[model samples]
Target: MTATESARPGKRGGTGRGTGTGAEAPRLAGVPLLGSLLDLTSDSLGTYLRARGEHGDVVRITAGPPGLRTELHCVFSAEGVQQVLASQAANFRKDNAVYQEVRDSFGNGLLTSQDEDYLRQRRLVQPLFTKRRVDGYAGAVAAETASTLAGWDRAPDGVVDVSDAMMELALRAVARILFGTDVDTTVDVVDRCFPVITRYVLRRGYSPANFPRSWPTPGNRRAAAALDELYGVCDEIIARRRRDLAATGATGATGSGTDTDTGATTAAAAGTAPGAVTAPGAAPGEDLLSLLAAATSADDAEFDDTELREQVLIFLLAGHETTATSLSFSLHLLARHPELQDRARAEIAAVLGGRTPGAADLDRLPYLTQVLKEAMRLYPAAPVMGRRSVDAAEIDGHAVPAGADVILAPWVTHRHPRYWPDPERFDPDRFTPEAEAARPRYAWFPFGGGPRACIGQHFSMLESVIALAMILREYTFEAVDTEIAVSAGITLTTTGPARCRIRRVDA
Candidate 1:
């Protein structure tokens, strides 16, 4: 069966025209040629908010130039979001141009891959993020959080850029969790290169001009240099791990068709011989790289160096960047509301007494989790999730033609008054067990849903919880700026550095 036929199995509805029957989705009229492009470019969040407020759940927005006009249908209701992300998800795929642009930099990693390749890659990496595996990394996360905060202890003015600091902390933590030994070097490389590459990618994705990366423009050159440095570091790490494994005779540790911690069968694992050289602080089975290195497919085929590098890079980038952004926004929110900050701090003190938090402590700190959830709802790390319809589908009785770009915006839906009353207010109680049970599932999907949802969500939540607990234990944060300027890119960020004043508390 064809994609469109499969998408709409039951009955043919709607007038075959662009607009459907029952309450046609209002289209935002724009300029003669530029259309809604200018409005979208200026302030996407504002534009989405206005469109949803004025036009209801489904709002049709037109952009691009005259002949090549691009139309996007923004779905901003729980029911509609469910249709796009869950019910009829198979009818939609990550064929968006923006996603394709991202693939150029990230390769065919999980975030960018689609169809059979995506499913295969997802299965390969799924084992690494199981709850058990994620819990195992909590100690590393807490340690990194404490170590990063130690530097803040000696700040002369008690002022630091929360965004940059969180990014640095998250980068170090992810490097250790993913690489294990000599992580400082890896973290340094990623920290230096990630910003340049991400900024370039976002710029290229957002700009209307089709500037190829090979153009050798100044921005492209810098991005290329950064990527080369990043890849070089990854190559070095992979080679070093393989050498270590070989020396220890741990190569092929999980032979063909054997179930390992990652729950996948490997053909020729990177084994290490006895008396292998081990780094001073390295612990067995702690790093993801070690696990991946010692793994092969069920068919007895070892992963190539390129494949290894891609997996490592994807984990390093996605593992840290989104968590850092979420933490930054969470901290900003708490700083703005002193009552919530005090409550969180009190909860931390009551829970830990005097010691640092561990994975076990995460469950006990419910308030901290609530705060994080609310913050994510208000300013999701990924403000929008874009998908292109592979077949003609009906969302809330509206016809979505094949190949149309369908946008499911958490930023808008999370704040939609229909689902969340007083949505703009920062109320952690909204996530309480009873309160959450009262709302729809797709109403607040910060990490997304369905089979394609983020696999590392458990890891992200654990890391955020531990980091927030550690910070709240020792320092009281206050916002420096009256208002934060939210900027939307690959991830949500601030226009300027999110600066906050920190006051050290008695231990």
Candidate 2:
């Protein structure tokens, strides 16, 4: 994967731009225009490595006909990401080609919105993710994990796809905390609906045209039905909560159960609590939804139900899939390298001495955390982040014009030899506090950076730490697959089943 081997011999020449020293940037001149374009859609990382090896960190690609204008592709250093994500950040906008499709399904959520809308939505949702609120939900997160794990077949002969299992686990856990404690009961419904929508998004970037109602495309029909069912479910829950508020003037919703109501009814039920909390039948604790429903900007503006639903759905995907992918991959890595897993377990034992991890325990479980960090560094779930240039600007001194897409990939960045020492190796100690402090800010961005960084990052980390610790404490995992192969879709995932054998830990 080194630059010299990847760069084509004759296609090497210096592009007089950026800070690159006289090294020639990789170019594929004789290849048909279609071939280059196909390479972009088909093998982005391969294209990036060639460019990086030839041109240094930042390299540009021309993917189409000369008359049509070439697409701009830049794979710069961590410092470049910092520059783009910071000081000159306003020049970069999130309206990318792939994300346009995501926005159609997710609506104007924080992840999709730009400018004023982005600022407003971020403000409302930020408070709910405060350290205190996140910590408060830890017990509930653990309880849900335990509940899910309780159902697993722990016998030696039983093999499970830990990736899929963790995806289901994460989806249910986040849904319960955000929507209601009983949301896990609907994981099957989510599984049924989400795949259809995600597949549609993957296929059809971001088009608004509705499919023919008569069209029997199973995916399309399923997506439409799932959307309707999800809305119906949310409305019904909201309505029930409203009814409960009318019957009994209550404010506190204990973590024991769920309240089904339309959001309006939930608000009505909450009434005039000092902090503007949700009704008794609302979610168990103050979740992201409740916070949005309760928030008002300095100007006293609030997000409507549509806005709330969009944001909630965005979190539904973000809060679950990406982290779950990382978790599943980490487990895959642990299975492949049992000695590494053993080292992590020994560290966990020395730190906690046979007890479930608390908030404080996260700091003590440094190696386990490092392992997770290394796993993500290599196999980032959300591999590619794209931003379209709204204003013509310079990215690492290359003239990037308006309307062109700019992509920064963690998949490439994490593997870049300049930043990552022995990039391909699965070494967790590299993420030690001292090691991290020595690296540039953007060198390790598993959850991304800037104002747009994933808000549920803390939530994801807490979930991962707890889940990994619990699994390590109870069982030992070994890989059954010959070699792990990754596929890129909505997130980076195993090409096939991530099968693993589990053996119970004996006292």
Kindly list the per-residue Cα lDDT of model 2 for residues 1-507, writing each as its tens digit. Answer: 000001111111222233322333344442664335556556656666566766677666666444443445464678767766675678667665456667766677877788888876766666666554565555545556666667666534668788778888788777766666447545666777777777677655422234654578886677778787766665555444445544554433222113222222322211222223222223433444454455555553666667767776777767788878878888988999999999998987787565556555567788999999998988888776666555656666555555655667778888888778788888888898999998888998877788667777877887788778877877788899847777566677566888888877763
Provide the overall lDDT of each model, using Cα atoms, as 2-decimal numbers. 0.74, 0.64
- Candidate 1 local lDDT, 4-81, one digit each (tens): 001000011112234333454678878988778888888877888898998888887877775556678788999998
Return the TM-score for each candidate structure.
0.88, 0.82
After superposing candidate 2 on the true structure, give the runs of residues whose Cα lies further than 4 Å from its correct spot. Answer: 1-30, 64-70, 154-156, 206-222, 239-288
Best lDDT goes to which candidate? 1
Tell me how far the alpha carbon of residue 121 in candidate 1 is from the true structure, in angstroms, after superposition: 1.5
For candidate 1, report its TM-score.
0.88
